[model samples]
Target: MLFRVDVAAAEPLADQIAAQVRGGILRGDLAPGERLPAARELADVLDVNLHTVLRAYAKLRDEELIELRRGRGAVIRADADAARLRLVELARQFVGEARRQGLADAEMLAIVREAQP
Candidate 1:
């Protein structure tokens, strides 16, 4: 697969990787069930860290755009509806996990409240 990384971009490397893969998925450049290059491979190509690739994969997985499996690596998810549902479930889990880490509902509420224009 032909992929290039822009180290000069303002966004985080993980976010940049996620945006490209997500756009490719939406534009049909990468089809459902297609296998993405392994994180290590992509990292080497991008001259970034393996953990950066993993972070990108994790973001795409959170977006329901990809499925990461042991040994099998990451693959695009085919079912759009299922992906949406999966994102919802992941959001719930993330919020729950954050709460467990001492980020209470009130603190979250305060952040949201402060974000308004």
Candidate 2:
């Protein structure tokens, strides 16, 4: 997976890393069982602290999106894609419900916008 970091962005480095990695998984850019670069190497590549990358990896692990193994580095979880797929399925159901309720696309989008963290 490709990673890019913006030093000037308001988000923390670890969060940025996690977000990008999650996005890659959702977009099918990262396949299950793919090994991520070592934290130290990724830190050097992104010019961030080693702990920053570790934190990101930990977050992914917590979400069951990746697995961190000794002598094996970080690897995407086999069932990781299921989460995104489920989200897509739920979205389709939600859109259908919204349509049935006579909600316009723009109205549904507005509701989604308001639900963002």
Candidate 3:
């Protein structure tokens, strides 16, 4: 899988890396049992610290989207569901936008209700 990061962006490098991996999974570009590039290798390519890549991998692990195995590196989980992951990604974006707009919980819920057919 290919990954990119913007050092100048407000988002942390690790978060950026994680997002890219997540996108790849959601797009079917990265399939189950596929091994990701080693953290050291990816860090060298991205010009970031090794720990940064590790942090990203850890985040993916926490989300159960990837599995980190000794001597095998990181691999996409066999049970990772693209559709469910996509919904989670969309919900996160929606909530972030709502927070930025200063909308209250009730207002957000109302909007979601209206959005439902």
Which one is best on TM-score? 3
Ranking by TM-score: 3, 2, 1
Q: Pick by lDDT: which candidate is best?
A: 3
Candidates ranked by lDDT, best first?
3, 2, 1
List TM-score per model, in order. 0.66, 0.71, 0.91
Q: Stretches of candidate 3 above 4 Å error?
A: none
* lDDT per residue (tens digit) for residues 12-114 in model 2: 9998999888878877888999889999999998889999999999988998899999999999999897576558557867997999899999999998999
Residue pairs clashing in model 1 are none
lDDT of 3 at 76: 97
lDDT of 3 by residue, 9-113 (tens): 999999999999999999999999999999999999899999999999999999999999999999999998999999999998999999999999999999999
* Superior candidate under lDDT, 1 versus 2: 2
Candidate 3 pairs with clashing backbones:
none
- Candidate 2's C-alpha runs over 4 A off are 82-117
Rate residue 45 of model 2 by lDDT: 82
- Flag clash pairs in model 2: none
